[model samples]
Target chain A: MAHDAAAGAQPDPSSGGWSREVDLPSERGASRLVMEELLEQLGHHGWEPTDIFGIHLAVEEAIVNAIVHGNKLDPAKTVRVSCAVTPQMARIEITDAGVGFDPAAVPDCTRDERLEVPSGRGVMLMRSFMTTIAYNARGNSVLLEKQRAPHAG
Target chain B: MTAHRRIDTSKVGEVTVVRFIDKKILDEASIQELGAELFGLVEQLNRKSILLNFADVEFLSSAALGKLITLDRKVKTAKGRLKMSNIRPEILEVFQITKLNKVFDIRGDEAEAIAAFQ
Candidate 1:
């Protein structure tokens, strides 16, 4: 479950970046390993603390949504994650094996009536932290991209 | 005087001041445990006022936010008040982004939050 740069995770020397693709089981607490590895890669690439925080939050939300909401924590289901990180940007794609969902159906948690709802803020947080968040037609796969700040890069 | 593995709690006058033990509150199991402990304060002990201090917390995800929201509801149902303080700028942004800032009574520090309970 431990993913380090040396053990299968690829570091692109030519591009001065790191990229990794892995399949994580649909289980609670499965995203910790990937988040640690991704954060390490971001730090190695000189991402600022603020930027790292946002990236970490956004990525965590995406993976959790994939595992819990999309996959429904089915042991048979797996979440496929692809991450690419550089000083300039970080891009992550996560896909889960499930029925998927409609992003439009999610209520606006920020609205006055829904403000007190205990759930449904994951998508909003992902979109706010990452520069761009896109979901495929199936809505089971999400791509999160964070463009590094000018000063941080 | 409940034992908590994921958080630390203390008494501040009538308010139960709580602090997180983990820097990153991302995982599901821990967040669940945290929710249990927080809910215990209102549902079990019947504490009327609570203040959660987040000085040691560096990262928070939507799951953790869900727990906090649920805890807020529990406190309200018990006719109590829940407040949070000492959140770092980055984590504070998470609240602002979700607009939970409007849902919870967030203060600048432990002292301010405890005083607000008065």
Candidate 2:
């Protein structure tokens, strides 16, 4: 599925130093390519390797969640990714045009029984990598942030 | 992005080396395919020593990590070992975060990886 281009327009640059919008299809290949581009852009902004890795994981998890879980891989819908980077932090939001679900409903990956399962680790990994994570009103949008550590901290 | 490539397996004495030339493994479908190939290879080959060369891979996702773990378990069940080499720092950090570093046998290069199987 594809997002309505007009409705999924890029975020305003006034909100942050850098911003971009991408329409991600249900195909894993397309979704992964969008993530790679996002990482490259973030890296060019001087993000550290750790920060880059964190953002990468967060983005991938969010996008995957949106495409697979939120949109249910429906070709008629789209997963939208928006990213904003500032001196203080970088925030990435992924939204899907689908029915929302409760984040608490997700199974814990830390538990031994669920570890071997092929899914359900994305949200946990995203939370671990991000400084803060929150769901939008519709629950289809996830906002992930990574604060730049103070030079001395 | 580098061109997608399949795993190249060759025998180094009794040990088998699986080289991954692709620079990234992010997609679930591809990772699943790779996992299946790895499982098939491990089954077809009776050798117990396996080395996965990742010199070309610059980034790896949790899905890739999961597949590695799955393959590791499969190999272990067959009384074999799975080792990795030439992991990029970025990818290594992902493994370290998940505490997989302690679970997988990782070496710096082909020589060291092969030496471990001896």
Candidate 3:
């Protein structure tokens, strides 16, 4: 579509979808620009509002984790992000240029004692909002996917 | 009283009612500023009964949630109470998913939340 091209999203001939790639600085709020474009593409593809909200939240949490936790907000580091969106689904991959950490090591924030803790809930929220989230062996990169829910009669 | 850029505050009886200025509370800077302003209400002004009205907030991240948790802790430590109301369904789902619904007293509306305060 005209809008997709204007946003630098090229046709994904394989799936009749569109895709985009971006490299973001390891800085707070940098993800906003990327999310703005991606969200527009999701809307253009006719995604439901609820699904879009979940996808937006999941991707945002992932990007924040990459910048804050993985890259530690080092100016020297950059987060590489790629995304593909179709009428049926959306997929994203984010990679950070810093030492990665173990996802499993993150504590369960929902536990009784940990309920009041201020941090460590980002990873859990990402997992809950995204349909599937997979991390690389080094945990420096993550892939998030969400499928469009069928329309109600 | 510290001037607030991220929140608007008013008093309903003895309760300090706070509403967010931002519709989407996600960015780091805003979250940080929000945390400071909210903590100031209890730590500096010593306003005991606090109600965070989420009527304007459509979206918030875990970082925002962190600020709320810390504010709750501060209120409890000061022997004050904290409650939230007017959260949209999607945002409410976030609390339910994280089980934070159990951590904070969430009311159906601002009037209900303020009335529950003692």
Q: Which candidate leads in DockQ?
A: 3
Which scores better on DockQ, 1 or 2?
A: 1
lDDT of 3 by residue, A63-119 (tens): 999999889988877888899999998999999987888999999999999998999
Worst lDDT run of 10 residues, candidate 2 chain B, spans B1-10
The 10-residue segment with the lowest total lDDT in model 3 chain A: A1-10
Candidates ranked, most accurate by TM-score first: 3, 1, 2
What pairs collide in candidate 2? Answer: A1-A75, A1-A77, A2-A77
lDDT per residue as tens, model 1, A1-153: 323323588878988899998888888888875778898989999989988888888888888889888999898778988999988989999999998899989999999998888899988988888999999998899999999878624
TM-score of predicted chain B, candidate 1: 0.97
| DockQ, candidate 3, vs. native dimer | 0.90
Candidate 3: what's its TM-score on chain B? 0.98
Between 1 and 2, whose lDDT is larger?
Answer: 1
lDDT (10s digit) by residue, model 2, range A2-107: 4433343254567446676777776566566466556776776667877887788778878877888888888878888777776678888888988888898888
> Which residues of candidate 1, in runs, are more than 4 Å off?
A1-7
DockQ each: 0.86, 0.40, 0.90
lDDT value, residue B15 of candidate 3: 95
Compared with the true structure, model 2 gives a TM-score of: 0.83
Candidate with the greatest TM-score versus the true structure? 3
lDDT over C-alpha atoms for residue B32 of model 2: 80
Question: Per-residue error at A45 for model 1, in Å?
Answer: 0.8
Where in model 3 is the C-alpha error above 4 Å? A1-7
